[model samples]
Target: MTVHTAPAPAATMFDVRNPGTGDVVGQYPVHGEPEVAAAVERAREAAVWWDGIGFDERRKRLDAFRGVIARRINQLAGVIHEEMGKPHGDAYLEVALVLDHLAWAAKNAGKVLGKRKAHAGPLNANLGATVEHKALGVVGVIGPWNYPVFTPMGSIVYALAAGNTIVFKPSEYTPGVGAWLVDAFSQVVPEHPVMQLVTGDGSTGAALCRAGVDKVAFTGSTATAKRVMATCAETLTPIVAECGGKDALLVDQDADLEAAADAAVWGGIANAGQSCIGVERIYVHTAVHDAFEAMLADRVGALRAGADSGALVGPITMPSQVEIIRRHVADAVASGGRIVAGSGSIDGQVVQPVLLADVPEDAAAVREETFGPTLTLRRVEDMDEAVRLTNASRYHLAASVFSKHHGTAIADRIRSGMVAVNSVFSFAVVASIPFGGVGDSGFGRIHGEEGLREFCYAHSVVRQKFASPLPLMSFGRTAKVEERLGTIIALVHGSK
Candidate 1:
């Protein structure tokens, strides 16, 4: 099928389509450099008005923004359901989760970013030092098509709450949802352009990075992240990359086979398995591998993909992803894996659920991210091997460990950002845990205290009540005082 490009603009806008039916959803402006530059200029003006409002007033406005989203959850979910082809209920859940993060950011921003007294130690106690977390200036956010609401909002809300103005570039595939969110925030803070939308394709994202924004926040593939970093490097723009994850799940022999199988199916197939933290591999204990695979096959076989009520799986969001999915499955099968459920093509967007067992370690299906409704099962001799193989991949985003007694220990050993001991995607729902990855999965964090700080910079300040008998910063400082300071520091923090 030929991919439909976005409608014509002064610049070419991306064509947004409904994945399940291949219907044209809508089109948006492909904002050019001039428009985005203007948006950032406006955002700067807005930041003054916004940052001056102080935390209390901003908190109220942010809360009102949350209400706007909460009241219209289903309406937003419908757009997500169509544009991304996630199940309606699941889409609703995604929107609701965004609202929760918005609330968390607003409620916690002051405490996290506010100026606070820091221990000056014996040396600096007389210096009256304090540490302040200040917002970085205008921030540029480049969003992804999958989980359009939840993903970008992770950056947008946190950035705004920390007093930074946001100029967002949403995925062209789901610009409507992005526009709706900005519009909702406007209703609460009409006085400032605190959060503005700059809709376009990769060029727009490129514009935002070089358009003089202080920093950029990106969520996408690692390959693209390297490019984004290179672009930002030109301007020395610091970036937070929340990229892809080839996450794994390790099952110990003592694990509940039924629970492990259930998690494997859900983690690999939810949202048609398009999640960044989606479970892509299963390293089952040899003792229980057969039982787990049998149960997984039974469960995954009953799953359906469509725009209908009975559908559990949904269409592939991006059309180009079709060939990628087919290739992964074909590679695994040819590498001696067996498909126990649906396989092959379905239509323009929808693809069938697939289960592969006995897949070789070197198969592309096991080693890379296919981002579709597929699972590769391999047996390991023991839990030790499970941990080793699970961490073998360069990507360490999220993982799950299912063991009745050793779940937490096994979870801690897996080298992923977040792990669920006996659940699936629980970290996302928790609201207080940091969400991000290590290595190829990308760096920086976007939830909890860490998320709150991602948008701010630390500042240290000191005030003197009187002329210090021991002065530092001044050329007049005595060498005798310098020696005393060294002794003081060693007496305090350097103690053994």
Candidate 2:
């Protein structure tokens, strides 16, 4: 007798909508485990050819990819704007910043990862040592939606420069942006699928993590990071997570209040405040608290959030984030805080930028990552108090300090991964400095020399130039040889 088996269910497709206009920008398949695994398999085969090419050839191809991005920057920016709900100009700026990083990674990869001579210690003087960083096969990159082009490129570009093929799983909200990136890369390096795209939701990302990729580079919330970590733990796969933050901005007594106010408004509300390193808290020195607060209120009050061309702030990209913003605002007001600038109204996905004053330290608005166009301001007795309050948060991702005379001193006291002195978010623009945080912000880094090494593993080699006189590593060693070695070591190292 013969038995009939049921067929597997078909994979579903989802629409990408614009938060500002409520229009479907694109539709993508919810790539499941099978599709994700197939993409990784292709990447693995491509990795072999990618790694075989010398650094000079890789640099030339990477430069060509950079050229593709530069020539079509406006088209890519438009996709980012439509899919992620940011202003078109801001999207252009985001894509423009990525060009600098792409160039830096391409130009510096050889210098950073090339083989170099390593010193052998006195005990092994007759041995020669060398070290280099080699590609770790295929890499899985899980990107965020807020800054779609910029954030993921921190991983994709660096990993590519280091000679690893990539399988990118972009956030569901902005799959079009990811597709555009992959297509553009293919135009430059058409020989193989050096970089590929797999669009889907959380399940797709989990599948990539479990698909035997050499490494996973993820950027998202701390809560979600835990889940990714758990999934990767199943296979003991290594990962680098760049998570969320509740960053702070400090104002010293001698700070330029005008500049501080400008930085606070831009840092707190830009991109509708969806940045992981966005300024969510402000600690001002009492001497200039009143003046700085007045300037910040005036500037923020003039800004508006909408789909209009002139609106400085855009709609919240993710719909669920609106509820979080609403809850934080209500909690701040109910806990004795007053809205200093905004109307505190949530109209659809457009949340007017709100500035809160006198919120308690333990309030949800102050302690949590609001992820909205909101700011909570508090006055402190001095710079010492400012530093203390700034370092109190569980998220130590990034911070900005404004002081005419003591900018560096105050920045040094704050405990965070990257600090901007007399400015805001400047560190992220520079390609040489590393970006990532300690504690809840997640471990491992992206961007800079450290980021290049993140996707590669160190390879060490030792060669013997001559036999050691003492032959410490030999089985034929005798007591007399050991005695002479002890006396020589004591003579060399006994005196401090």
Candidate 3:
């Protein structure tokens, strides 16, 4: 990893360490209050240059940024691997997915938010009407460490494509990756600080919310998101919060256990199971629970977490996360849940896959988001019961359903904002679909057309083709005009 000389009066003082070795990989400038405030203030000015360039010009710049990302994909991935401790392949995949989102956002921003004519209503028939989406100035983004590139890039690239400058605060755990992204973007648009970085701890993130940015897009835990929202609320800044999810996977009686096991293991244990949309709960049909558990256990037991190619998963990305994983495991075992395989713990940071069965609904393992290399297996009477248990959480981010007959129906009923019917998180990978949740999981959206719109506001325009003798909006309105307006409204909207 490249190390720049530590600057005096460091704006940011974040430490980056390899999760597996506990070795200090790097130290980043933890952008402070004044610096972050300056960045946002600067981005506001940059927003003018970025937005004034127009859509076509912005597309050209975005395409250039894409070339930068593509050219240094592996180099960027190496930084990600060193910072977040994920497998090299996983890191590459994360950046690759982000490349797709960048391309989609730049290509489709115009169509999704362009001006369109609309009915002025019968009351205003004399005037024409249209609405066009406009950029929302400077946007601040707080990102997570897991999928460090893909998740944050979802907001940063889309915001940039929408003609808004971005000041991003990536998770301190992966500040290096965030810094790398902002630096690369600068190469494409070197004239302005259109994309800037704020590196620090939670307080730095709070500083961002308090900054005068137009909107804040935060992706993290529900608890932290609440704090971030409250901070942003002081200024009434609109925010898009993508919080945690204790997502579940339901298996119908006629479903395939082998395929379900494959998805469950991949979704739950991949990235060391740190995914917000990762499968933490599994509700298998009672008749098939045993077979399904056996298959899941066999698959999970074979998998290992290491920095080597022989193992599929890497270590826990955060040191604090290891304890959280251990707590959830111990809690589940103490609550009468049986560990079917791999109890947990390893040399430095590796955590072996664990499968828990008979986990009580009241246990933290079942309700809370463990966000680790663990899975809770349960059996329900039918799909109805499965849906009931799935929607029991305060979070509704993402979910997965495995069923031969009722996958779509079950998925539709679940309250999550996104779902993968026969797969895991396929919705997020598809650049056209929106990814976000409602309720405690937070509001607004990112990715696809929705992601682009979140960074902008609609501007309506109305022009009259020809003036009517009867203008209700003016003081010239008379009894005859009122009667005529009522008649026109009734004719157009009443029985018709």
Candidate 4:
């Protein structure tokens, strides 16, 4: 007898287009709710095997994964450049940053998550305590199109290093890039599906939040984050949202005009200003405002945005963002701001870098996240006013301070989660520094020791070495023991 089952219906499909030319770069499966749920279920099984391997063994596999990425760095960079329309050099730089983070997470995970002894006070001298960060089973990572490699790796790598299995949902615009990453990891650790990919749009991400994953690490706009949070709330699933930011750069009177101008331009316009930490506003002290403005104008005048090989800035990845950029620039000019460089124009998906000066403090260009290659400059009386204006924004993911002498001092006064002094985007490159923000920029970190711990839950164990002379955990304690305990507590802590 021959028995046969009907072939499963073909999965839904979608096309990924290149923003630069609107050409079909690739086609991907549109993974829906059932597919997402199945991936998470598989991840749960993988998580057990991954967790049981222990940190030392996991480190070996992670290091091997890093080696594979390093060997094929240029190939991955090409995919990033093609899908996202970022310059090849910029794509390569972002990939290199990922390698650095991979090495850091692999090298430090054992120490950061490994069991360690905790101090037992004299009141509990008979007890020994140890704590370890255990993996939270499976994690769902929803990534953004911009800086797809670096941004998603910030969550994906850290989660994997912490021993949690991952089910990734890359942005719809960059599914090929995401697929490449997962495929590379498979080549290195072939035994288990420690990392997997599911490709789709916003609804797919919502499906992931409802797919029964232990935690969801999301990187996108603040508005989208709120929606994802709402979906996850249904299952009470914890989330880490790395959302949008209106980051700023503050220039003091004593700042080096050339260095500050260069940093501000690059920080604001690099990656076509799609970075969450990209500087959108600049505050200059009146003492050096004119000099800085002239320097900025001269520098900005030479840059261009195009689809050509030499262009520093490329086409906007999301076509819808081009109109948003237009609206912001129009609003800035209407609010009495002056455009000092490049015509505020959008042709197809290519948006020319627009620099506006004297923009109203309340204008959309200043208050909202444009996520485009636009910079708004405002002159203040001194560094104090600069800091005040910078801190006034609703989003505060990161900022940069440019002052020769008061660099660190000024950085300390900023309310952002991370700040770069004398340089721009420096904190992101340092794997040891935590990356996240408060308020509308969203909460939870994705890098460094805090990042490794983000995908884990603490497990504490206490062992009794001997019986306590006067046990507080027992019901048979007498009044004399209670009096002695009260006296010890008062003597040790009441004086303060």
Candidate 5:
């Protein structure tokens, strides 16, 4: 006799709270394994219909989805600000960039993924060969809360453009934003659940990994990413992880001190420094270290963390992150590091910017990813020393180099997947450049041509146009024919 077990039922419910205030914003059901598996099955069914439609029709639908998002950009931004605690302006910027990516993916999908002719070598003179990229049937996306709209949309938009359906499991901290996005998309394409949403905590995410989707896309911390990978490994499911990073910024002696200071302040403290590619460490040449430190301190002093309308920095989104931020600051100061700018203080969820100078490379503040409004400054003897220090970390996601004459040369030496020359975070806004990292920062890309193909599968086709002059594949080949073939191979390839 064979045994069969029933799917698990939906479990408990949780409340979404505003981090700035401890008030409950909304409530969501904690979907269980059964719900997650059902969502993936529906996505699988929808993928068939979605892929059957031609690229032109798919473009129309995707463009319509983009239109819906654009029209309600402010509304979506409001949700992001409320749930994730980022400033309204910063939230708006996140949504705007997502819109740009959507437009690029819809416009370039056909040209990038369509079938193209391939040249058949002289050895196969009578064959026609071509290659095309097809959609992976269904994709599972586990998103993050920091930049909820922009980060997950990097996978969602590309997957949809590639003609695959999506079952998105957003971070438990920001389910409202995810629900809003899916609702807006549904208004555009209502026939099928082309883009579905399943709200829950980590258990739901783990379930999605075991739900048999064609591929899973995850964006989170390095520690959490490992757990996600382990769960996916149980089912032999493929996953793309855009994990954490302790990114760095390098300033050469020839660099503009004012510009470097400005970039450092913004890159390190923006969004309360919650971004994966956010600048956590700054390595400046010893010659200009003092001047740069002064300018950065002034900039940091001008910034304030509050929930008020005039405040530029918002409160920390995740509650657990506040302790980590405090620990890193305490650790830096305990290791003989000097506080240069704002005090390393935290009152409730709002944490003021903490700038530390002369911190050792081995300190936790410099070694681990402190996803808060904190910056550590270090002085290096030369650009070589700066590059050496920058490349010495375990996490290498993105980096920035500020140099007057050797920006490109300095950028090339860094081990990060992407680097900005004379700028910071510039690679993220550009739709054509790939976004991802190597090593502990996580593998697999999420943007550009590589990103569009990330949710797709390559397909090749070959056809015989006529019979070959020499029948080598046949079992009845004469010994003389085999000898002639060997002689021809030796004459053509032996010299090389």
Candidate 6:
């Protein structure tokens, strides 16, 4: 007779707390390697079915999924506000953007990734070629908490639309929001676990990278991205890392100061300045520096960060971020940076908006990713200096240029991935454009046609239409045939 041993205990559990209040919003398991592996295996099976359904059928399912999210948008928004400390209205707005992107991804995936004929060169006229994008099997989405519903969906929705199943590992700080999203999708497509949620911290994320998923799409701090990259390297797994940014906004002498100031304030302080694309640095032409400063000061001063329902700004979602904000402000002031408006202090997790001026270019607040409700302003001699300073940052993520006549011209000069002319972060809302950055801001894209293709591998097909008299691919070709092929290549390419 054999004795049966008791099963191992379940994984450790953790609590997700509201940043505004110290209250526990929800509790979830810290999924380990075993659970993550299981999720990946399940996703692999689901991906087979998901991808086999063909683009038209997949589009229908995605449309239904989008409808689910739209119908209970408020519910998801509530979860976002509770888990991440964004204002209720702001949370709603974030979900609205997600809905638009989801709809676009669903409607356009077939057109973007469908098989299409590719013209064969004259030398290969006997062959017919076509190109198609095939799903990567399964995708592991490691999401961020700042815009829980919007940011991850950029990868999740597009990957799903491309016919890949997903194993989403949301930020531990906002696991409840992740749960809600998965639940919503299940309501529509309950046949299989097309979208699964694995809740935990960095270990869980690492497990995902190593669990043999087709690809991992991550969004978080640049430092953390490096770690994730290293983990993915262990498995030779590819990843799309959407990291942090110290984005800038440029103001020209001819800009509409009123519009520029309003956009800057919203771009820098909304969501308590947690956005990766948020404007943290501003370079203004000296001609309108004073006027613009005054306008910005008035706007920032009127804004407050609080836990109240009507407050425009909310508390810092991650407690550790408060210290970073505090340090940046203190360092700026110590380096002779003056607070033009609002106080540079932290009351618990609530950091009042601070507009700093005269900070040195090398100051931590200026050079670093100060993910806080603060903006550093500097006056430049001209638009030349404005563009120079804007491109100097190591984080070439995104930027905004404000000029009545030269907005596009100035935007084209910036080294970032995308720029908005006379506006802030507008490129993100447009469904056709890609969203990403160069350098430390991370690689790969998350929106538009590029985004849908990001989750797929190109599949090329070539069919021989007829036997070629001069076949280059056969080993039995005669020397005369090779000489003729060489002559053809020289004729086609040597002149160019």
Best by TM-score: 2
Q: How do all models score by TM-score?
A: 0.94, 0.97, 0.95, 0.97, 0.97, 0.97
Residue by residue across 29-71, what tens digits does model 6's lDDT show?
8888888998889888888888989888877887888888888
Error of 5 at 125 (Å): 1.2
Candidate 1 runs further than 4 Å off: 1-11, 471-495
Model 4, residue 311: C-alpha shift (Å): 1.2
lDDT for position 292 in model 3:
91
- Residue-by-residue lDDT tens digits, candidate 1, 1-496: 1111112355565678887777798878888888888888888887888877877777898899899899999999988887788889999989888878888888888888898987766555456878878888899999999889999988888888888898888887888888777877778877667888888888888988889998899999999999999999998999999999888988888888888788889888999889998989989889988888889889988888877767888888888888899899998988888897767456767888888888888888888888999888888999999899888998999999898999998988888889999887889877777999999999999888898788888999888756666778798888898998888778776977
Highest-lDDT candidate: 2
How does residue 110 of candidate 5 score in lDDT? 89
Better of 2 and 6 by lDDT: 2
Model 1 earns a TM-score of 0.94
Clashing pairs in 1: 6-14, 6-15
Per-model C-alpha RMSD: 3.8, 4.4, 2.4, 3.2, 3.9, 3.8
Clashing pairs in 6: none
- The segments of candidate 3 whose C-alpha lies over 4 angstroms from its true place after superposition are 1-8, 346-348
Clashes per candidate, residues 3 or more apart or on different chains: 2, 0, 5, 0, 0, 0
Model 4: C-alpha RMSD to truth?
A: 3.2
Query: Which residue runs does candidate 6 get wrong by more than 4 Å?
Result: 1-11, 486-496
Residue-by-residue lDDT tens digits, candidate 3, 335-366 = 99999987676556788889999989999888
lDDT of each: 0.85, 0.92, 0.87, 0.90, 0.90, 0.91
TM-score of 2: 0.97
| lDDT by residue for model 5 (103-199), tens | 8989999899999999998677889999999999899999999999999999999989999999988899999998898888887778787888888
